[model samples]
Target chain A: MSLLNDLTGAPPGLPPHALLLRLAAIGAVLAGTTCGFAYVGGWLSPGALTPARVIDRFEQVNGPHPGFRRNHAKGLCVEGRFAASGAGAALSKAGLFAAGRVTPVAGRLALAGGQPYAADAEATVRSLALRFTLPDGEEWRTGMNDIPVFPVRTPEAFYEQLLAAKPDLATGKPDPARLNGFFAAHPESAKAAALIKARTVTAGFADSTYRSLNAFRLVAADGRDTPVRFAFVPERAPSPETAGQAVQQDKNYLFDALAAELRQDALRWHLVATLGRPGDPTADATQPWPADRETADLGTLALTGSTPEAPGNCRDVNFDPLVLPLGIAPSDDPLLSARSAAYSQSFTRRAGEDKTPSAVAGAPPHGAAL
Target chain B: MTPSPRFNLPARLLHWSMAALILAMLLIGVAMVTSLADYHALVSLHRPLGILILVLALLRLANRRRHAPPPLPADLPMWQRRAAHASHVALYALMLAMPLVGWAMLSAARYPVALAGPLVLPPILPQSPVLYAGLRSVHTVLAYALFGLILAHLGAALLHALIRQDGVFSSMAPWRPRRAAPTLRPEG
Candidate 1:
């Protein structure tokens, strides 16, 4: 029989044994083709840039330092205790909320971007990242920002935003033409910009509210689940004297203000969890839940003490959102995983830098946090 | 007299409909990845269109099983005949696998497989980023392979029509004569 007969499933008149052999050959070909295609797409093809490369692009524009993060590089480290109220047990079984359990929390308050000495008075996003270590060795880490909504929905868009924000080398200023084009193309970002423009800038970190922005899942003991977002709303009233005040001229005014306030009184924030209803936009962190969504006050976070310098306890730690204790899981928000991946890449590169000793001090006092 | 060479009416209709849908899907898929401005809108169209293609593919498969395809010309070279048969099997396999992998990828990513608002398909795979990444790569590679095959199929159809003037091109064409032509080109 000809090759055509064998390929077309042993055409009429072929022997039974020959037909079986031809069938086997066809199967082999299909399997081989699939393997070949997978190998090429997954590894061989030069496409889908890695997270490390994306982080590198940012470092290229903003020169890298020996001990600074790709974003939120300038920060003050604080050591405190985060006592969980057992009230959260009804919503999630995470061990940290086992009522009255005080976890030694190490945290950092930083300005967004890679500039280690960026002025505190400049218009920028402020981040509050914390790590809570349980007795059983499990840790829950979270990095939150003051903004209610993130600028972009996906990691790819975030990388593009970084590229657009990079300052032109010759001018030493961010090119307006590039930023205008990016904003026009990605209109979802306008919501974040509008929020920044309309809001009254707070006086200090203690009074500012920080939002997790991404939705996460809370599983109960009965295996029931609820989607929720978290926020740290300050318990203290907005200082009447500082609210809506003109930008301070001193470069270290916010940090100095926080240190003075902490000395006089303890800082506290109500940890509130907002429950997501059906049809809530959980996938996109760029969108906020409806105003009428149900919410529960999970607990209170009290910052009782402050340090003069960057605390060594939190310096090496990365507050990856994916590092959660039992009963808490990441929602389908793509940004959650994207953040973890980018954070991991940043951690690895910085850790690598640490291996090579440089003239920079081994530990710079966590840059001025209370 | 021998019957006029052509696929059944049902088969012909399915072929044309699927051809149009698949081409449009390829274009939309490319546009979705390359441009973020149109990604959301293109994705909305892509999900429903994928389901439509899958349904048509299944219907076409069942029709093929019930109705015998017109035989290849007896005079065609053995290698060409083999190439034709192999490509047909590859095409059918890709048509069935593309939508399935797409649905599976979304399921792995913990995303709802919604065809339209309030019409969501149940998850076919457990949620895992590793699994999702693997399936996503497979889906993309399979798409490129399917596209190449479609182009080859179209080229072969045109060759039969313009160069060989063979009945093969007209076998699945929308219009076919009621009677066989008296001066038929015999197989080599």
Candidate 2:
């Protein structure tokens, strides 16, 4: 009956039964998709796997490092003064960031992952885990990774990735196909892999940038809440030789470099936070906020001195992000809670081992000196 | 043979274009889940392709609403006729649902849903790992359902052309004058 009916066309009638079937089809689709999603949500979350079990699995696969827990096993503990600027107070009323007030900072620097003996040259990620002890007895702790984005989005996915990366019994090396399959299914991993390949490795800890890679809610004194992700941007430029250089001058070059730098003068890093807009990601650690997002330089972190034995100070302290001050709180990011749980499990296991801290005999109290 | 009536040109164009896009999406989806070498390339391709399919599906729905399709043959069994209508409805629903689900899944996972630099879509839902995982599984399952429905649709079209010799196939693709005649018009 239409103008184009001269060509091939459907019959001119719409039977009531056909219309009813169409309506039923629409209902079925809506119900099916929603129910399917609900079923998946109900079954396959962190609830299906406990943090303790995941840690135990990690130990089973990697074999626990004797003195160190899970990640950043080889580290140098240092004492510092963190002076917050007026800008920091504007973002959060936390005492640690009060204008010009110095908070005692105890922190560690390490090669990423669990191998204590891994060389600087072999490391792909560097870590800067810190704990700021405020005068009011409140503490702000953060475990930062040099990599901008994480390899996976969720802790459950991370557990699966670790299990897949664990070495096979036959060859004593992880199966390449399994890792490949994991990567293929999880396309979010491509961002991290590409970044690792593209960015030039920093020669030492002094020049590297550490990204928190997790969003947190920062509430101001006036009760306005802003989601923020912060980064430790280095004041010193990286040496040209660091770019694509495979050879480390020595096995302990990073630690030696940081210690040497600290001995001369306090090393400074801008503690900056990127403010998140309304739709910014709060749950996923793998996602980086947009570059042009509003950012505030919260303060300066000055590394005053380093300790040869970090086990004395930082080893007992879990640098849990959830250990927030009054004005700062964990975002809904599942990784934040997951990390807190995992860190507790790790701390419990390591402390239970009853391994005595190999205290550097005659070393001065570093935090008190700072 | 009489010059059989066909769907309006806009409807035919939208049908074939969407058919090609959906098939490509299915194949790419399969390849992306299997091969690491192809994963990055396929994912990049998948995002833009998904958005295109979504846009075209909307346009097709609008067109279909204004221009009703030709009716089934009178001799067609009631069950088969009902199946034909239901499948089309399912296919259309999937075309609309898949892209939105993928976008929301990425949002929930806190990943950028972008086709290029500065082109990221706003998050459709808050970041929640549980929600992300669930949506991801739903997207995959629906994709498989879509793929199966497509195959059945193809089978029905062929049966109409070869055995029934009805003009149903021609209703959407009318360039070919005879049942077996070849033409520049692409087959779904």
Candidate 3:
């Protein structure tokens, strides 16, 4: 009787308590259906609400050359220029550059890979580098990753991370010795390294949520700053007990499943930034921000739109942290600062096609966000 | 008694394998560039392989031209034939264009493109910051363009393999089943 009253939109004759229960049930059913379908199909389908709908969904994302990439190589011949922006203007005249946002940004993200085409299941943590030009014409970079605390800290350590993961000198195999150095040198990395190692040996994609162990400084309009780290909490749950058993059966389980999920629903991360405050733990890229310091909910990050399905898996979409808008800036944590330059160099090296950003690179003061 | 004008084994291997590699390359390229720098060596391998694909794609195209493709299926629609022709042209055009643009962009930026050996590829574009930045974006823009074209290519290939089940797929089939081989292989 109470359930019946809660439904029917709670007519004046119905008791308030009864009406409330009915409404709650209906809401629960509707949400459950969406969640169920989300697992089946929503994860892969790129809706108008998709996180990365960078192209023509809303008017805000739309810009002068909506889908254009500024041609640096072409401008080399014609405009005597190398800037992506300048190339865009020149190409627009020649009917070359297509419509895209004027203030272009670039981003790159990746995980540590040992074999050239090794299955992603192997312990591979993620990386993101973004670069954006501000309204004031200044550029800011934000370098981040999926692990909450990085195994290496300073630029020197970052360099060592490269050597540790590099090919062996004698046998041309991945050097196991150097790879173990950081783990041995800093016991703190044992925690980060353990998480990384389990990812390789484990199987459940649901129970596994990755983190960027580095801290970033986000400056707000009120002159307040927040030191933050990134984590991508999985939307679905997989049995932790079965995670190991599943890995033996399927090596590429996480990647393959994620690919299917992407086909259904856009992967979304609630961009929550942990603030460094008097009440919070030290906010340093070298130190893992405690779970308790979780502060502002930055925004939601999702696959906006993929012209081709599984873009990061199947397209040329680079998701570097350096690709930024106006306000977001990278901090002075030596690793974050070095990544900006390193990424730009790596990106330029990776792309053999066309265009370079700027020859003269600059870094801002990192004590706080700009 | 006649050999099908189908691509020679090496040509076919290069064709189909490279098609797979290039597509994989693009995706891996996309993902690698977006990453925060966990594996620099893997990231390092991306470019050399891209340039390698560029070279291999060129050689593959040249071989494709040298040895004519098997005659079009009698039932191939007129539109598909034209599309087939145009798509091949575009594929070759992109395969050739993308690397050069990358090389030129690199040249403009003053970076040496190591072409898988001690020898370095010559910089096609002179050093100019204004030109370098523009070419780099153009390089990236072309990268996206290459991606779009590759998607179209994939759709066509999948259609031929799954829907048509025609000889069209044989051009790049990893191992064309001998006429006597049974079709009991499990699905992907």
Candidate 4:
């Protein structure tokens, strides 16, 4: 029996090569497992900005207001329909752009800030987010801002800007030196900021021209794609009342005006697409396409009613910018994925928090005719 | 009492197959959290594989109940025997709990548990962000625990096979060794 055990190379006394092989196998497994744990634990990859970290920074800067969006926390939901003109069919085959094709839309109009109750005069940025539920059930969601160009080209730059803009403890305002340092480091951001400062803030959400800052591709039947940037150009001209002076009386002036406007009459905006040329910048949102680029009027969006955001309302929706239909695809812009990730993270965080009923007064509850 | 010399074929088969599935699951789980480029692909794989693990673990539990594994050598220390049994219980618990927690987490987040095209499992819990967050943290913590337990299990198996040269390792081993030595060292 002992001779047979020796011949079969039994353990308790492994041959040198066999022992080495076994030890090496064990070592390899341990090393791989260690690396895997490190990677999953975020130790192996240091300084890598993840979606979680981005959301964390947002909460840090804004302070958490549970159950509300980390940004664009103040908003009232609107229901609308998009009436497509056949003119857009030439550029792309999206069903929403077919002649007289009307798609149901759930949307939100909001001022750009983390504070849900910030006074209207304090908000310079306005946002129009929409979700068009197509005939076949695929949804095309887009979140557009009033600015003609994005303030930052990439998410990292946006993070840097957030840090620089954080309120200093010594003074409630952002440190001017840090803000200047950020702008100096990112010239593109400085230029975009200058351009934004140059434009007059619209009196309210109804008159503001909300632009899809990022470029998207419109795919044709033959598989050809045309890079395009779009904007919702409001039919209503700026109200006679200037935003800062007229809305200062009400804290929820922007939402109040929007709700009142929708109550009296339907608000309308034309979906205009700017066809990009070969030399146009598709990835960088900060760079605007030339003014002379051909523009196509896709259709009109007629918002019929408003609803306060609640569980079953548009409040549950993430309004992820990357949720495109079959005919539209995201550009190679890095911000697209970054935005999607951050939005998903934000949605997850808010979805778990205590549900806060929409504070909009006199608006119908969720699902009440809106 | 003297026990059977080796585990039944069903136990061995389940053991080896589950070993492979679990190792793959751990690696895929790690990869899913780390890579955004392949996130969708990994998720598709993850959801199905997680369900499969759950089902196999159930079968494993049933098989274990029906067929008791071969006993350790009588000379083995009482503390080691208790530890071996406790770790095995822990392994089984995690195997069952991990998939269920993951399913509950997705359900809480209102994400469909798609088994295949057009086939989805119904939500096991209501949509609540607090519940989702809590379950998600538990899932992550349990995953690390499972991985650590597996490592310790592997180390113990190696110890038995190489150092103890006892039949404990060969009992559940897929293939039989050439020589059938019941206990190479009585001291062990």
Candidate 5:
């Protein structure tokens, strides 16, 4: 009893009545701290969808390819320069849009799945991620994909899609029923898939148009902001043989063709910004603006050289979509922040893993003259 | 020389300011990990705030060396005194280690700790994925441990003020409690 008293009771000098109050206060503090721990530890809210959880789901689906991105694992690096066309100055005051202003760029071209060794033919969505280093030490990094619009609107729906797409152990492909259910639930995704399917696959990455599916704000010098969606439109016309028709027997056919194209001469793409009206949906990536929206030629991106993925200049870059320069800012696009978070998590995970050298053959060394 | 009955002005100021800052850091750290919408803004605030805490911790340690804290009440139990000492040591260790470990984790991941415009802290450790993963885990565990210690410290301080009325809490409190008699000695 004395031991219990000592444990729960007030100190020797304090009155007996004080014990109750002290016990209550102590209980309150304990309860408060318990709640704090629950909140901070993410226990209070069970099954909460978090960035870490999303990345973890990617790992679960992809089966742990170390030292590679959680998504778009198979890739090759490219280096070049972005030359401003001067036309984009009217839309925004970004230096990259200033006529004659040229900036260095390190970029990665990759397929959309998490399998680093997946066959080139399996890739339906191709991606181009670039980091443009400005003269003032600021950077504008963007991750663009060939798709006209993203499949989902919010991160939660994206997570649902990821779960639905998880391959079954027996078939090694996403269950058709689950996928159909997902598409049925998310009509936006169904519409996007239809639109993507309607477009013909380009002969190679060099001829493909890479789009910023999310909208962003271009801040003018006068502090006015213009909502815009942009795309890197390839200068090369699509070859007669479409990518779907020309799926070669080689597993790395897409990357090989890109390398071969780069060897002949530098490839170029025009940066075109599609201005948005006041009523345009800045928050939804799945919705595209009307085809008649005005566009401004921002600049030309020239791919002067290529490198293998692992040792390349773009190896360590996260290419976060939200890393914009002073004159540019993210729109209300919910996907932008989600993309940044997921990219950061992916970068952190891959940074700790032993990087397997990319299987992309016959690429120039890391610092070859651009 | 006899120690002053109350904490020195610098010590008091540092204690309160650091208390506020540390609480804010903990909240920001949790928010950064959980919320995507506020992650960027929180990160911009988190990096500088961590460095500030680190600098203030160093200054507080140095001040503590030069001027010792007022002695605890004589009536306090031996175990309680020992716990107080141990918890203070752990608190100080975390105050120093959390930022250093966070900085090291970022360094290991090759992340730039941008403090302000044109000011970035150089990486303190070589970039290594294994080290980053380990340090990141350690930092998180220590944060929870620190939270627990703070709760205990607060509970003890309340005990001193409300029940014991021993002037122990008033020694470091920003304002003196009316019931704390000036004649109360270190030996309660």
Candidate 6:
């Protein structure tokens, strides 16, 4: 017993590899890149959550914007520029710009679980969301889902579908017949539904795609107002065999993969707005931008050092169509209007609930089945 | 009177290992309560780990009671003995309190506990903002109290090793008394 005890005490700590892992995690948290133990990672401490840093970091990436104001006390204020301001279209024109690069992007991939939905696993269809912070302190938030379309058009409809799809009050799960009827009734969701049906399902919170259903006008160099759809296509589509399989003890596969790729290869995106070509229909995401193959813009976005995360430059800077400048205005689609309204509600809802601990996001419609 | 035997090696090991984890956890916990943004995940990670510590601490106590530890020095003063026992008692009680308080806080906060991967821990307490706020305060204060107790323990151990030249340091020391080990024999 003494010999056995002696051997163990000599080590007197967590396993060697475990210790290394802890050190690595601590290092990453300090660096503000990896979300350590926390499933959602960003700023660690409140004092560290300063608006000045967020703005400055944005300025550093996108270039100096005189319109951007930091009053040393009023948080952060930035004036909007129409997409056509095409003012500083190139890197040279912009003072602190990274120029067309998509370097630093944090991707969250999750599934659309259909039941009690309390845990992180059990559904599939890859939901991907990413936010970009240009050096000028300008922020862009892009949310996309794997499927091209979604189940509902309006926020009100969305709410209704979710409530109907939620579990039966008595049984505590979705009624199969009710679920089928709900899907059948909403044939408009056929595109998304077909893709979802064929797609191999994975971890609920890990395997899903999120879409920006409403049309967004892409203010091209020439200031054209054409309807466009944006997506967060997986950089490299994983094998179908990899579908629905959560790695043992791996809490953050998507994050880990994204971090490695950012470190290894430069990230790029196709910033194609609806061309609104003669044959194409106007931008109405509710009705698909009339059959133009998604074009590639070859814009480059690189993360210089820190992550452009929430409340950071990208997150803090408001990106509502209501606030868009003269050139890149929101299209006149009812769904677009509804999205703006719904997203506004979600934003305010999220913000308000965030203040109190009881306001967890696990509420009905989005999270827990109720 | 007969002296009790020293704690079993496994029990002693779990004891100190948990001690380190608790200290580190307390510091991180203090940092976490302030940063409300990512607080969810931190709170989630913290709850289960705290519960694990509490259960482990309880088992340690039961084991110790069943298999009492070796006795203190015969020459030890009454005051020193009292201090040692009191500090240890505080540590164990705190080990139990912090986690239970955190669990209650989350229950009030209406947050579900995702235990070790997919297993969702049942909420042991009902939702009550007032109770949650109070429990949160209790958890924080107890953490500070725990820190104070740890410091006192460390200071006393150092005092025994350096100034008092006594046997207190041997209480949790990993070494066993050997025949050739030096002792503070009185000067002639």
Per residue, candidate 6 scores C-alpha lDDT tens digits across B1-188 of 45433456866688678977786677567544433233334554676788789889888888887777766555556787898789988988998888888777656544444455324456677655446556766777898788778767765665544334344455456777453224433322
The better candidate by TM-score, 5 or 6, is 5
Question: What lDDT does each candidate get?
Answer: 0.71, 0.71, 0.47, 0.80, 0.83, 0.46
Docking class of 1: incorrect
Interface RMSD of 6: 16.5
Better of 2 and 4 by TM-score: 4
Q: Candidate 6, which segments miss by more than 4 Å at Cα?
A: A1-139, A168-173, A199-211, A220-223, A234-238, A241-244, A247-269, A272-294, A302-326, A353-370, B1-188
lDDT of 3 by residue, B129-154 (tens): 44655776776677667766765666
Instruction: Give me the overall lDDT of model 2.
Output: 0.71
Please give the range of 10 consecutive residues that has the lowest summed lDDT in model 2 chain B: B179-188
- How would you order the candidates by lDDT, starting with the best? 5, 4, 2, 1, 3, 6
Cα-based lDDT at residue A204, candidate 2: 77
Quality class of the docking in candidate 4, CAPRI style: incorrect
Q: Give each model a TM-score.
A: 0.56, 0.55, 0.39, 0.75, 0.88, 0.38
Candidate DockQ values, in order, are 0.02, 0.02, 0.02, 0.15, 0.40, 0.02
Model 5 docking tier (incorrect/acceptable/medium/high): acceptable
Q: What C-alpha root-mean-square deviation, in Å, does candidate 6 show against the real structure?
A: 24.2
Candidate 3: docking tier: incorrect
Q: Considering every candidate listed, which one attains the maximal DockQ?
A: 5
Tell me the lDDT of model 4 at A173: 82
lDDT tens per residue, model 6, A1-370: 3343233221223355643454454444333422332322224443353222333343343333232221111111111211212222431222212243333343323333321112333233444444443333233444455555555654344544555556676996678786677667766554545655565543332223234555556554455445555543333333443544454524434434333444445433333333445444333343454454654332332222213232323222223333222223355544444433333322322222222111112112323442
Cα lDDT for residue B148, candidate 5: 80
Go through the candidates in order and give the clash count of each: 3, 11, 94, 2, 1, 45
| Top model number, lDDT | 5
Per-residue lDDT of model 1, residues B1-188, tens digit only: 45436798999999998988887787676545433234345666877899888898999999999887887877677888999999999999999899999988766654455565335577788755556657777887998888789777876675554334457777888887556533245543
Give the Å error, residue A291, model 2. Answer: 1.1
What's the candidate order when arranged by decreasing TM-score?
A: 5, 4, 1, 2, 3, 6
Candidate 3: segments with Cα more than 4 A from true spot: A1-110, A114-116, A126-144, A165-208, A238-252, A278-284, A304-318, A353-370, B1-188
